[model samples]
Target: MKIVKAEDFDLRREVEYGSPEQNEAVREIVAQVKQQGDAALLKYTEQFDRVHLTAGQLRVTEEELAAAYQQVEPSFVEAIAAAAANIRAFHSRQKRNSWMDLQPDGSLLGQIIRPLKRVGVYVPGGKAAYPSSVLMNVIPAQVAGVPEIVMVTPPSTGGTEGIDPYILVAAAEAGVSEIYRVGGAQAIAALAYGTESMAPVDKICGPGNIYVALAKREVYGVVDIDSIAGPSEIAVLADDSADPAYVAADLLSQAEHDEMASAILVTPSPAFAEACRAEVQRQLGELPRRGIAEASVRDYGAIILVDSVVEGIDVINRLAPEHFELIVEEPMAYLGLIENAGAIFLGPYSSEPVGDYFAGPNHIIPTNGTARFSSPVDVDDFIKKSSLIYYSKESLLSNGATIMELARREGLEGHARAIEIRLRKEGKAGEAE
Candidate 1:
């Protein structure tokens, strides 16, 4: 990994995530799916995922779902069930009830919270299997009372046999039945624009490769998306008191994700930076995904030297990483100083993987500098809100002329007339200026 001063570090490296050709490819996929429906979906699935399927074979069947349980071990099943329980318990706290408020003007004003009727969750299945993503994406929708949650994952090989057993088992545990064996930008297109075999969903959520990310970006306005997720990133802000081995291990965890993934360390102590960098090089030799991790760390990863812990916090906020680990002497004392991390790990014990798997928080976090504006996937992602306004005759009569005046100020005669007609009927056209 490269070691540099804070002034030499570039924030722009993480900001620009993908290429234009990737965006254009996603656009073509979305356009074709919208035009040809199942035909285009199946064709692209074959081209991208190497899986060819008929209309009937596009969707996973009940028999396949049942066989998934038999293929997976009992212990694995129990573990997912437990994880689901924790995920459910945490998201249940975010549940919102439709509420009403009675105003002094005798008007009923409130907000109605309603879950999307159906949602689609994309779980990456080609190079890796993230069953944890299934639990993260579907559980919140279930908590929000989403009636139907459909899941899509690319088939493992060119053959259209079935999905990864662990993924199926996780989907089953999370109460997602409508699953399709498709992936890449094609699967995203299929979800955003319904094919003959599938129905269009209200919202789509999950993470994927660059193709998947670009597809979500293309189809954003047509259907709601959680966020334009980027490559996985982690930043560790540590001091001399922190563990070099632990910090190295944590940094390598994200580094192994992909070549584009970023793993950075910021510290004031020069000795600690050298120790951690050496530890990372040593550990990288032992990892199975060493080549990927090595490339990520060598390319995007860095160890930045700051003047102090306060200066480290300034750099963290400037970069706004998706995951942050604070390994200073008093992690909590500097908690208020951090302003831009998607998820913060306060102490040495709180590793990033803990939140990725067993912890209650959703692991589908905003990436890149997006943490400055966006948030992690939660119950709010699966539900929609409607502002409720029941203006009584008295309230309207008293405020109608004021509204008309404002509308007229904007030169919107139609809007002013709409309010004027009701005020005149109520015999209060001249009321409230």
Candidate 2:
């Protein structure tokens, strides 16, 4: 880890937009899926995943879902069930109902909140195959009352029954059964444009590789997407009272995600900063993903020495990290000072993984300083809001002239006429009464 002054360190990381070859390849793949449908999906599955499959084999069978249970342990099932419950409970609070407000003029105005007709969730396979992510993506859509939640993963994740059984088990526990045995940009196009095997979805959510991210960006307007997620990030603001070992372990948890992941520490105490730097190096050697974590720490990780905790908070706000931990002596007192963070974990025990796995908050958060404006995956991602307006004749007569004036000011003659004709028909042509 590198040590630098707060003023000297730059936290802005360049966003990965994929290489030109990768982008062109994704465009070609998306075009093929749009034109060929299921045939393109199967072809890409064989090309990318090296797994040959017929159109009939593209969808996972009930037997596969049932068999997935046998491969996973009883303990895993129990734990997933418990985690699902917490996720449901947390997201259920976020569920909203359609509302209409009645006015004195007999007009009705409000929003009609409705769940999407269908949704597609892409789960990564192989090394990135996290069962917790299955819960994170699927459960919220379910809570939002989305009628159809479809999942897609590669056919084989170097596992004997094709897809990872643990992922299948997680999907089953999350109450999702419409899973397809396809992956990559082709699957994204299939979800967006519809195929013989799968219908088009209203929205797509989940995390994937560079190709997947590019595909999501390609199909964004056709079907709403959660976000163009970037590398994982974590920042810790601690003091001398905080445990250096605990802070180091928390930082590594995110750094181990990949070589692009970032982990940083901001503290006013020079002694605490040195101790954490040493502790991170010590703990990095013990991680199973040491090669990846070591690279992340060496390239993106840093410790900034601030003049005071207030200055540290200012730096954190500017960074707007994906995950933030406050480990000062009085964590609660400083909570109000945090302006930007995807997820804030205060005190020592509220580790980042707690929110990632079991603490009920969605781990799919904004990254690359996007927390300044965006938010994590939630029920709102699975639902759409339509504005409801029911104007009474009296209300229209009262406001039609103002509406026409604004429309004409914008030089939209048709819009003004649309309101003027209505007013004229009602015998108030000159001006709204």
Candidate 3:
């Protein structure tokens, strides 16, 4: 990994999200899915994933779901269940209900919080299958009280009959039954615009490759989507008191995710920075995904040296990494200083994977410096709010002239007229006009 001073670090690499060709391809795929429906879905599935299936076969059958249990170890089942419980517990705390505020004027003002009717969750089946993601995506929607959650994944090659059994088992454990064997931009398009077999949903969530991210960007208005996540990234802010081995291991965890995945370390101690640099090299040699991690660390990873831990925090906020590990001596002392970060792991024991796998926080986070304004997947993603107003006759009569004056000042006669007509009916015509 490259070592750089905080003053001279170049961040241009983090800003460029995807290529134009990839964006254009996603646009074409989304258009085809919208225009041709299942016909388009079938063609793209065959072309991209090397699997051919009819419209009837797109939806996974109950028999397929039942058999998935036999393929995995008993322990896998137990682990997913425990993780689901933790996730449910954490997100349930975030669940909200409709609320109303009564006024002295006998008018009612409130907001109605209702779950979305349906949502489509995209699970990437490339490089590796993420069963944990099924739990992360589905549980929040369930907690938000969404009735229907549809999952989509790419079918693998080598005559694989259906979606990965691990994903199936995770979905089942999370209480989701509707899943489709399709993925990429085509799947996102199918979810946005209903086909003959699959109904369109109100929102789409989950993380995917550049194609999937670009597809979500295109379909924002057609269907609400979770934030456009870029590559996976983790930033570690540590000091001399932190362990070098722990820092290196945690950095490599994110590096192995993808070639574009960034793993960075920011520290105030120059001696500790060198120690971590050496440890990362030693650890990188033993990783199974060495090539990918090496490339990621070599290309995107960095060890930034700052004059003080306070300055390091400044650098961290500017990056706004998806996963931030604070391995300093007093983690909580600097807690509120961290204004940006999707999820923060405090101390060496609270590693990045702790949050990713089992700690109850949603693992799907905003990447590519989007944490400055975006957030991780949560119950809010699967719900919508409607403002409620009940204006009584007396309230309108009391405020009609003020409303008309405000509307007239804005040069909106039609708006004033609506209030004028109502005020006249309420015997306040003199005050309305």
Q: Give the TM-score of candidate 1.
A: 0.96
TM-score of each: 0.96, 0.97, 0.98
Q: Pairs clashing in candidate 1?
A: none
How many backbone clashes are present in model 3? Answer: 0
Error of 1 at 270 (Å): 0.8
Clashing pairs in 3: none
Count of clashing residue pairs in every prediction: 0, 0, 0
Model 2 lDDT tens row, 104-124: 999999999999999999998
lDDT order, best first, reads 2, 3, 1
lDDT by residue for model 1 (1-433), tens: 8899999988765355468887787788889998998899778877876777888888898899999999999999999999999999999999999999998989999999999998999999755799999999999999999998999998877665578999999999888888998888888888888988889998989988888888888888989988877789999999999999999999999999988899999999999999999999999999999999999999999999999999999999999999999998989999988899999998999999999988889999988788898888899888889999999988888778788889999999999889887877777756633
Deviation from native of the Cα of residue 143 in model 3, angstroms: 0.5
RMSD of 2: 1.5
By TM-score, who's the top model here? 3
Instruction: Please report, in order, the local distance difference test score of every candidate based on alpha carbons.
Output: 0.90, 0.92, 0.91
* Residue 198 error, candidate 3, Å: 0.7
Superposed model 1: Cα runs more than 4 Å off: 14-18, 429-433
